[model samples]
Target: MNVQRGSTTFLKVIIFLIGFAVLAVCIVLLPEAARRDAIERPGDYSLYPLLVCAYGICITFSVALYRVFKLLTYIEKKNAFSELSLQSLEVIKKCTFTVIFFIFLAIVYLRVHAQYTGDDAAGPISLGLMGILATSIIAAIVDVLQKPIKNVLNS
Candidate 1:
């Protein structure tokens, strides 16, 4: 039990680091890159919508990450089978689906913009596809995790 608690503590630290890394990317890297792109292509009005979608995806991802952290805390408290943990799992699943929706919108926006502008949308489209794939996997995992919790709660 001591070892398990120690492992959860370590996992929490890792999760915090992951969240911090994402925050830095959202705050520092994304805006800078977007500004540079806008300066280089001043007429690309489609950029704003794609950026909005990207931010939406990031926000949903942050919510899911926080929920995962909460779920971990529940586990550490030996309340992983409780309603709170189940709620956290459901929130994570919902967040993942929200991200997927944003990714899809971004992909469609990029594709349509590229069609009008004759720009190659391959890179962003590929990234969006991968994002969708990842979110789908996360949702599946959450579904599987929820089943056991639901079973425990119902019993």
Candidate 2:
């Protein structure tokens, strides 16, 4: 279902867009500090690809989150689990898994960056990554626990 119509959804889309912009700036600007002969540095912008992957995962999760909010509204209106709502929930579960998996991968990428550059930047990166991991875990648990309850409610 389309999420661009409602005012609340518009706010969510704006938030997502701002997040993407910040990520884009980081991916573009951070690696320029590396000198060509810097042995500790990768000397290449390999981190950009990983950042792109993380951004993609984040966008997917953001979209899923938006859809969930929309589904909450739909559920309030219908007071029952329509097929579309269940499908949306299932999709959200999958998105949660995807987000978690990508966050793990991004952690690995960040580790590589830390090792290659000796930049000691991993602390903040790890914290942000952990936040993403926590978000994914919460989403997964909520989805799993709510699915059957929603089904029973519909029945």
Candidate whose TM-score is highest: 1
Model 1: per-residue Cα lDDT over 59-138, one tens digit each: 88888889888988999988999999999999999998899999999889889888988999999899889989988998
lDDT of 2 by residue, 52-71 (tens): 66566757766776666666
Name the runs in model 1 displaced over 4 angstroms: none
The lDDT of model 2 is 0.66
Clashing pairs in 1: none
lDDT (CA) per prediction = 0.89, 0.66
> In model 2, what lDDT does residue 5 have?
43
Q: Relative to the unseen true structure, what is the C-alpha lDDT of residue 115 in candidate 2, on a scale of 0 to 100?
A: 90
